[model samples]
Target: MCSHYEGPTADRIHHAFGIRPDGPVQTDLWPGHRGYYLTSGGDSGGLSVSTGTFGLLPHWAKDVKLARRTYNCRSETAAEKPSFRAAWRQARHCIIPAEAIYEPDWRSGKSTPTRITRRDGGLILIAGLWESWSDAEGLQVNSYTMLTINADQHDLMRHYHRPEDEKRMVVMLASGAIQDWLTVPAGESAAFLRQYPAERLQAEATG
Candidate 1:
């Protein structure tokens, strides 16, 4: 799962997606932390950038600990899973703009941190789902989770994680697909759920 990533700045987001931010800009973001995501700006017919908890918090959830496991939604089961069904059904989709995503490489019999970025050295927009839930204080708070798909066939992604574990990769959108990603209906959105080609990605071990 992608628990941490380098978030794009608000200005960068506007330049890339033409979405005016609705809140403060953030940089480094991790699960349970706050960050910005781009979604369809309801009524305005344009993209809207807004802050949300990196981990998802379903409206019916009573424990924030649920967030620990909800940061990443399996693309195959998102529509059927209790944790993500609501957002998936409502088509509450968003794009998580990131500079890089960190993963663990255990090929050396020990874990090594690896940073994955675009070969073009540009932002990577990951497909995600978002939901708004009321906190204990009765305030409506927003949260989101990235959507991931199997990557066992991927050349680069398969090299990460333990050899015994099934490989997974987040759904990264192409520069031209951001608009369709945010507006596509839920029933027709499955086409967007797939691993990015390793040829377009670069991964390196980080000290």
Candidate 2:
């Protein structure tokens, strides 16, 4: 699962996805961190970029620590996990635009930071589910969690994280399918939950 990413500015996001920003954009986002998420704008065929935490916070969560663990939901079980079922069922889909995603690579007998990006050097659109949670003060906190699909067989992604751990990769949506991902029928969303081919991706170990 991705714990951090480099996102674009609001203007760049607006131009790239036609999503109007509802708040300021966050260039750097990490789990339990706040950022801008682009959600569908209904029949208008537009999008709304709103400030939301990077981690999902179910309405029932009492502590913020849970946000860390809920940052990534298994696409295969998102519909069944209590923390993500509501958002998945309600089709509260969103997209997280990222310049690069930082993960740990443990292939060298030691863990090292690794950055993953499109081979074309363009921003990646990651599919996610968002939800709204309110605190005692009635503060509405909207948050999101990336959906991950098994990637054990992926040529590049499988190299990240610990070798002993099951490999997984974030669901990436193609530029042409951005709107489709945000508005796909709930029952059919599973069709988009698959590994992005490694040939179009690039990765480097960061010192």
Candidate 3:
């Protein structure tokens, strides 16, 4: 599974694509940070990462902090888990615009990182889901999670090796698949989602 990502050009491309660019975050030792946000039905908000927390605000949520830890959702059971089922069924779908994503190689013990990007150098429309939660202060928090699918045998898999890794990779939507993925009725089988070809991605090992 991917635990780190890069969104260097998120802001520049979001507007060009008619989407919103949330905000960026800076980690003490990380190379760089960027942000991405989304809006729907006249509601708008963006995502921000601070202290390693990624904050997302959805139209339905009253607070945005809830997204701090919900950045990833497992595809194997996302449709069955309480935290994700409802969003997966009803309020489903989000766009995570990223230039590239980072993956670690544990075998080297030196944290060898891999940068995965689209072969075409375009923004990757990562599949995600949004949800709203309420805090004690009555503030609503909006959060999101990136969905994962089983990774195909490839050079990238050499680095990710958790017994529970499940060999998963995030679901990178095809240009035309976004609208359909967002509007498809709930309870529908996700078979079509698994149909995307895996050859569209390219990954390289980096420092």
Candidate 4:
């Protein structure tokens, strides 16, 4: 599963998605950090950009730190996981735009950082769920997590991670289907959990 990525800048988002963020955007993101996500059915009733903590903070969480361990939710078990069930059941869908994603390459018998991106040089739009948590004083905090699917057989994805572990990759949406993924009916959103074609992606070891 993906826990690190090269996030897009506000200007890149405006150019690729046609939506401008309300404030400065974070470009480097990891668990427990702040980043931007897009949703369709917010207070605006249209596509809107929002800033949220990278790790999902469930309603039952006593503190915002819960995000650290809740950043990557497996799609196969999200419906039953305590940290993700509510968001998954409520269809709190979102799209996380990134310039690239980082994964570990272990083919050399040692873990080396690798960067994965589209061969076309377009944005990598990842599928995710969003949550809104309120504290005792009514302070609201938004958080999100990337969803992952099994990638054991994927030509490109299977190359990363450890050979002894199950291979998995983050769920991604085709650039043309961004709106459809965010607006799909509940219980049916799972249709978009399919893998992105490996032929369109490229990877390289990074220092």
What would the TM-scores of all predictions be?
A: 0.94, 0.95, 0.71, 0.95
Query: Candidate 3, after superposition: displacement of residue 101 in Å?
Result: 0.8
By summed lDDT, the worst window of 10 consecutive residues in model 3 runs over 25-34
Ranking by lDDT: 4, 1, 2, 3
Ranking 1 against 3 by lDDT, winner: 1
Tens-place lDDT per residue, model 1, 130-178, is 9999978898888999999998998889988888998998999998888
Which 10-residue span in candidate 4 carries the lowest summed lDDT?
40-49
Alpha-carbon lDDT, every model: 0.88, 0.86, 0.57, 0.90
Cα lDDT for residue 199, candidate 3: 62
Model 2 lDDT at residue 205: 79
Candidate 4 stretches with Cα past 4 Å from truth are: 41-46
lDDT of 3 by residue, 5-78 (tens): 76544455545465443444432112112244332322333332212224333444434444544567777787
RMSD of each: 1.4, 1.4, 5.6, 1.5
Can you give the lDDT of residue 28 in candidate 1?
75
Candidate 4 lDDT (Cα, 0 to 1): 0.90
Candidate 3 has which clashing residue pairs, if any? 62-140, 63-140, 63-141, 63-142, 64-141
